[model samples]
Target chain A: MARMKFLCDAERCIECNSCVTACKNEHEVPWGVNRRRVVTLNDGVPGEKSISVACMHCTDAPCAAVCPVDCFYTTDDGIVLHDKDLCIGCGYCFYACPFGAPQYPQQSAFGVRGKMDKCTFCAGGPLADNSNKEYEKYGRNRIAEGKLPLCAEMCSTKALLAGDGDMIADIYRQRVLKRGGRPQTWGWESAYGASG
Target chain B: MKTLVSTMAGLTLLFLGGCYESPNVTTYEPGVYKGPKDPLMMGKADQRAETLKKRFELVQMDR
Candidate 1:
């Protein structure tokens, strides 16, 4: 199975936030609970750019590592999912995640966070494939349906790309070669560690 | 019995004082977002552009 991934082209991203709206509409994500968002750097600056941010579905996901009940799991396609039932409302995943992907409802009076939620890469969760349980917990199983993530598909500038890692990397490489740009050195190294 | 009660009380105070250290990686500096050129010593302009290109590739592959 091909490892799934997401790539956001900062150069091409107009920060239109079409991807963010598409994801929210597709998932019915509650207010204050955005599964995807556009983060702008150097807002109002001449060279400002916006990059759509969400779960990268990393190979060595930090959230998965810190989950107390082993709620998190990775699929053959490289999507990271979790068992909501098994979650214990711990916020370790939230603190550990570099992308700020994990989110929890403020259900408790003392601010005891609720079960963690994040991007499922549109593949849903540990619940049975395409079952009502899965849909109820994780918006949709688009990957199982052989469909790409709604965010990437709805991207206005085609700035957000998602799919097989090799293919995505190649596409990015081509763009860089064409534009005479160099690779970023911070995020992947800091989040995943230099060894990666 | 008195000593035991005092010890318990002390422990409770320590725990309830929000002094319990978390096991999670606490080295993270919240509200401090890092950019591509922030560390790794790469050229700022080129790094940002490259990072964007990488992100684009990921999205494109799924297409």
Candidate 2:
């Protein structure tokens, strides 16, 4: 099994929001909902770090645990996804998720929360691969086409990485070795825990 | 005597009924996924991983 995961290199990230733009463009994600965003720590400081934030698609997802409707499912590649039709817009997953990955769209004038949406790792949802219906509901099915997420692919600085866990970790390890420094893989420990 | 016997039988039934168990309800299991299966899982995962490995080597390894 691949165990697909996302890793953001804080040292490499320049907070350009290219990943964010790439995600929005690729998915046509709604106005209020951002599937991916860059968060910068210690703003205005010279040594500040920025990292791209989204669902880590954890080995053991907290959102899945807290969902009342049990709509969440993990793909064979370890991508965390939920059926929008099954989601009740309860916002439990939002609270449970450590990375704040679960997002609800406010489509109506009343500001009523829509179904929960989160990062799917570009694997799409529980629908036919590359179908129009699936695209309408869950955006692109790039994983089915053997492609990684566009957010990572379009990243100019290669700060955001999406792929198999072990492979990406090896890549990061190599980067660290070359750079000769200990750099944090931000949110990995909380999302995936120590063993992951 | 008949009244006493009826009371005893009723008590015994009540006691046995207290011990009767009902069928377990089938709710969603914790940590188990209850949603529809994804399309990506339908293909050969090993082949997919291999393809991804090649991609990583191409784009990520040298960077």
Which digits, one per residue and each the tens of the lDDT, describe model 1 over residues B1-63?
999999999989988988667788657443222211111112243433344345445454434
- What candidate 1 keeps of the native contacts, as a fraction, is 0.07
Model 2 misses residue A31 by how many Å? Answer: 0.3
Q: Could you give candidate 2's per-residue lDDT for residues B1-63 as a string of tens digits?
A: 999999999999999999988789667666666677776778898999888878766665544
Tell me model 2's lDDT, rounded to 2 decimals.
0.85
lDDT of 2 at A129: 91
Error of 1 at A31 (Å): 1.7
Q: How far off is each candidate at the interface, as Cα RMSD in Å?
A: 14.7, 1.7
The numbered model that scores best in DockQ is 2
- Writing each residue's lDDT as its tens digit, candidate 2 over A40-141 gives 988898888899999999888888888887898877778888899888998999998889988889977787899988788888899899899889888998
Candidate 2 pairs with clashing backbones? none
lDDT of 1 by residue, A1-196 (tens): 4677899988888988888888888877766777888998779988777888989999998887776667776665567777777788788988998898888877758888777778888877665667787777788877655567889877777778887777778888888898885645336874688798
Task: Give fnat, all candidates.
Answer: 0.07, 0.66
Runs with alpha carbons beyond 4 Å of true place in candidate 2: A184-196, B1-31
